[model samples]
Target chain A: MLVEIYLIAVVVALACSLPGVFLVLRGSTMLSDAITHTVLLGIVLAFFVVNDLNSPFLIVGATLVGVLTVWLIETLQHTKLLSNDSAIGIVFPLFFSIAIILITRYAGNVHLDADSVLMGELAFAPFRRMTLFGMDFGPKVLWSMLIILIINVLFITFFYKELKITTFDPGLAAALGFSPVFLHYALMTLVSLTAVGAYDSVGSILVVGFMVGPALTGYLLTHRLKRMILITLITAVFNSLVGVKAAFVLDTSIAGMIAVVTGITCLLAFLFSPSKGSIQAIRNRWKQRKNLKKQAASSHIKS
Target chain B: MEQLLALFSDYTFQIVALGTGFLGLLSGVVGTYATLRKESLLGDALSHAALPGIALAFLLIGKKDLVYLLGGALISGLIATALIQWISKKSTVKFDNALSVVLSSFFGLGLVLLTHIQGLENANQAGLEKFIYGQASSMLLSDVQLLLAVGAGILVLVLLLWKELKVFAFDPVFTQTLGFQTRILQFILSAMIILTVIFGLESVGVILMSALLIGPAVAARQWSDRLGVVLILAGLFGMVSGVAGTFISSIGRQIPTGPTIVLVLSLIVMISLIFSPKRGLIIRWVNQRRKKKAYIKQIEEKQERSEKYAR
Candidate 1:
């Protein structure tokens, strides 16, 4: 049972971190934050129409809302009235606020609450097992998260070059006949789909943590895109494992413990990484200064 | 009119509305500095980060006291801000990356602490979860008074350092060149923003507080380019949203105060975006069309003169 929970956590974290690398590189991590929140509104609206929480329509609705969020933010940004960040700040709250209001008002008797949306119950995930024709398929979350992970991997593999070029230099990508806008929306859709898939177990806030934390920790350790992606996956898996163990020991929220571990890992990398750590930079500067002094003394003696 | 009078007469309604209104006014005034500094989202992160502080304070003190909880929130929020600044500065991570990571991780830690508290055999823990979405109707007279006093103090600080803040907001480089302590000014402004978030936690909660901070300032910016005017307009917009949201929510069954306030504030932002006299999309569109018509008229007259000359 615990293994299933860990599996779900690890898979969800990996799935989120894939698009997160591009988001971190493209400097739009906040867009993921905004998308995560707005998808709740989509879920709620879809629930109103479908009257079912587990229906596939919820994911469809969330993805559509996620795309709509990006479109709205971009349109508002293009007006030049506000900065892109401000545009994001303005748009997401509107969607999220409406969602909350809907849940509190008409959906009072439903299996939805703002608390569960923010702090998901990961412990109960294993109990909700998947079964087909008297055969046990393990936890529902595991299968869903696995499907998301496979989709994410397939997407990254097929469009690796296009994603890389567009993320690094959209102008070059456009000049080379690749539509940056299309790729961007495609990435955002993937992010949203992954977010909704992961939403049931880790909730929205943890989803943001899973997406940004591992990618950033990887970024601190490597500069190469492939290396960064590999490191991100490793960090996600490592954090999820440690986080699960720690949460079990402490009897606390698994997602929160994972997030805390993510923070610590990023901090450790920031302080101790060989190439880009601050401590490493300080040591290099000191060594350079010492070498310069030695060279100056040698020159004086020769003179 | 009678219902409005009755609402004012009701003690609970009066306290909640007054407290939220003052909160809105205060955050609006202080949040301008944040938005101008491009740190609007920092408020979002700070509010979420403050949650663990409240839980920790409750654990240590074994009670749910407002002052100490807010103090704890302030301390943790400051720590989060410091971490964000340090991470972005020292690492290869950008500001947004640092922000999202710190924001979510801090919030996640808060959740862990909250759940731990929930498991403990204590009845006092029941009220702490209200900070997540907030229960404005539960506010007391003392809460309103604390809000008023702290809000006034912040307002006084804003006034005392108005010139420095304005300069810092518009151009930190210029502010430093003018012999001002840029770091101290930044600390002061950051403190002010954090204070606003803490006070607002009870009224608007963590999730919607960013909207309160960002909405009013963005809407105010649309109306005027002047900083002072924008501040005043933002305060007005925020106050109106708070009071109006409170009233509407009070009348409706199961309508929450925080989301209602945010929805109202977003309405103000949308209206300002589309309909403001200056910097509005509608107005800009109209002006462009008129200019195009005039230019076309001039071209036609020039064509007629050239044709007469050719004849």
Candidate 2:
């Protein structure tokens, strides 16, 4: 059961980190943060329609709302009325606030509490088994997160070129006859889907940690896109596994511990990565300055 | 009508309403500066990053005193702000990435601290979690006094530094060229933003507090181009939402004050976005259509004249 929990955490971290690479590359990490919050509105409204918290339709509803959030922000940005960040800042809270109001007022007696939406109930994942034909298929969270991970992997694998082009230079992508706008929405849909899938496990805000942290850790270590993705995947698995053990020892929130671990790994990479680490940069600068001083002294003595 | 009167007469309602209203006003006035400087999302980051501070404060003090918790939150918020600034300055990482990373990691640490406290089995820790979603309905008169005192101080500071802040927000390079200390001004503004976020966190919670800071300022910007007008309008809009949300939530069963206030503020934002005369979408659309029609009309008249001259 404990191993199953770790697997679920790993799956969630992987699922979040894949799209996170794109978000980091595109500089839209906060959009993931916004979508995580707004997806609650989608889930709540879907709950009202389906009247079932565990309904598969909740994911559909959430994906739609997430797309809508992106659309709204883009539209607002096009209007020149508000900047992208301001648009995001305004839209997400409106959605999240409404969702919270719904849960507190109408769905107060139900299981959709706001705390679970933020903190997530990862420890309880093992108890909710997915039984098929009376045969238990381990934890339900593991299966859902596995499927989301597969989808993220497929999306990135298939659109690697288009995504790469659009992220780095959308104008070039457009010149190559690829619709940057379409790809943008497609990536956002995938992000929303991943957020909803991981929503049950890592909650909302921590999803940002899982998504941005590992992707960034990878980014700090490498310049190549493929290598970055490879590094990010490794970082995700490493962080989640270590986080599970730490949580078991400390007996605290698994998601929180995972996020802490993610942050630590990213910090390590930032401080120590060979190419981009601050320490390496500082060392290089100092060595260069020393070389310059030596050259200047030699030139002066020869003169 | 009687229910409304009864609500007003109720002491808890009065305190919560007053506290939230002042908080709204404070966040609004400060938030305009944030939005102008394109730091609107910084409030969101700061609020989330404040969690660990609250948790650590509880662990050290071993109590649920609001003052200590907020103080802890302030210190942590400042630390988070400093870290974000440092990372952005010291690395090639984008500012947004740095903000999100710091925000979430700090929040994660906060959660860990909270769980640690919970594991300690302390008696006074029961209500510490309320800061997560906020329990404005449970606010005491003293909380309001504290909010008002600090809010007034910040407001006075803003007024005193109004000219310098205005120039700094619009153009920091220009502000520096004019012999003003832009770094000090930047620090002061960020501190004010952090203070506003901490005060609102008690009522608006971490998630929705950004809305309180951004919503009113965004809405008010739609109506006016002048900085002073935008600031005053945002403050008014925030106060209205605060009071109105408190009222609406009180009348409803199980309705939370934080989200309700946020919803009210969102409504104001939507209205301003669509209907404000100067920069509103609806107005812009209408003016564009009128211009298109006039252009077509002029072309048609010119064509008719050409045909008559040819004949």
Candidate 3:
């Protein structure tokens, strides 16, 4: 059971983390945050309309709301009424508050539990398995996550050149005839598609951590984009495993533990990366000072 | 309304206003440094970090004094900042990396402890939990006075050291070249932020205090280019929001004061961004329209003069 659950955790972690690399690089990290929280408002509204969590219409409506999250944030940014971060800060909190307000006001009418919707149990996920085509398959969540992961991989692979170009240098990409805006919208859509369930799996807090942590750790470990993606995926999987294993042993929340483990790994990378490691850089400075002092003393003797 | 007043009137409104005001004044003074350092986000992180401290304070003291709870919160907020700073300095992680590390970890740990604290099932626990969203309506006059002393002292200290802070924030390279201790200046500033946020956590709660710390400073920035003016305006804006938000929340029974204060702060930021004289959108539009007209006139005059030459 734990093994099945851990697999689901990995699938969700990868789905979040793969796009996270691009999200962080594009400085849309906060976008993941905005999408994650604002989607709750969507889920609540969808639930209010259909009153069912398992309905496919729920996801369809949620994705539309996710797009609105980006749209609202962009619109807010355009108004010059708030700075970029401030606009996001204002809009998401308002949306999130409204969702909470709705829940508090209509707790009985709503089937969407706010706390569970915010965070979910990966262990219990395995128990919700579905049989597809008469073969032994995992949970519907696992299948959905795998499908999203495939989309992310396909997008990353097929448009790898375009993505790298646009992300690294959008102006140049535009001048060279690629539509930055198109790429931007498409990427945002992908983020929304992946984030809804990704957020559902480990919760908003962990989804962000996964989205941010693996990619960030990879960034510190390497300068190249390809290596960064591969490393990010590996580290994300590792985090999910450790998190799931720890939760199993300690009887703690898998999502919370995963967030903690990923944070710890990022800290380790920060401390020990060869080129930019803080301690190594500081030590190098001290060594240079010691050599300079010796040279000064020796020159004084000669004089 | 008269009957309602007769039934509901008490010391709580005045006390809550005084508490929010004290918080407004203190954070406004200290947050200038937070903004200047480009570490405004730290306020958000630190406020969240105070949860563990609040829990620890409750456990260690086995008492429920506001001062003790806040003091413990202050220690934890400082710890969060210190760990973030030290980890960043000692490792390759960037500032955000250090920050996110402390933020979620501390917040998660706090949640875990809260699970235990929830089990306490006492009167203190009921009121104490209000710190999650803030229950400013419950503030005692004594708590407000304590906040006043702390806020006033910090305000005086900031006033005294205004020149030094100005020098440091505006041109750190220049200040360093001038033989000033940059690290010490940074330390002093961050210390003030930690202290301000500690007391602030009680009134505004943990999550929303960052809105208080950054919102006024951000709003004030759009109105002026001068550092001193920005600082003073920010402080005033903060005070205005604190007071107005408290009054509005008082009208409603269930609305939390902290979010109300932040909502008000956001409105002020909106106004400043759109309408301030120099940085605001209106000024830019007016300037651009004027420039475009002058350019069009220049082209017309050149075309007319060239036609006469051809004739």
Worst 10 residues of 3 chain A by lDDT: A81-90
lDDT by residue for model 3 (B226-284), tens:
88788888888888888887887777655667767877877887788778888788888
iRMSD of all candidate structures: 0.9, 1.0, 3.4
By descending lDDT, how would the candidates be arranged?
A: 1, 2, 3
- Can you tell me which runs of candidate 3 are displaced by over 4 Å? A45-91, A106-114, A117-143, A286-303, B1-8, B56-69, B86-94, B112-132, B138-143
State TM-scores per candidate. 0.97, 0.97, 0.85
Candidate 2 per-residue lDDT over residues A76-192, each given as its tens digit: 888888878999998898888889878877897889987887788689888988999999889988998889889889988899999999999999999999999999999999999
Per-residue lDDT of A87 in model 2: 92
Docking class of 1: high
By summed lDDT, the worst window of 10 consecutive residues in model 2 chain A runs over A113-122
Q: Candidates ranked by TM-score, best first?
A: 1, 2, 3
TM-score of chain A of each: 0.96, 0.98, 0.92
Best by lDDT: 1
Against the native chain B, each candidate's TM-score is 0.96, 0.97, 0.90
Per-residue alpha-carbon lDDT of candidate 1 for residues A44-129, written as tens digits (9 for 90 to 100): 99999999988889889988999999999999999989877888988998899999999988899989877777778788888888
- Comparing candidate 1 with candidate 3, which one achieves the higher TM-score? 1
Q: How well is each residue in B1-311 modelled by candidate 2, as lDDT tens digits?
A: 88878889998888888988888899999999999999999999999989999999888889888899999999999999888887777888888998988888888888888888888968888877777787788888888999999999999999999899999999999999999998899899989999999888888788888889889899999999899899999999999999999989989888889989988998999899999998888889999999999999999999999999999
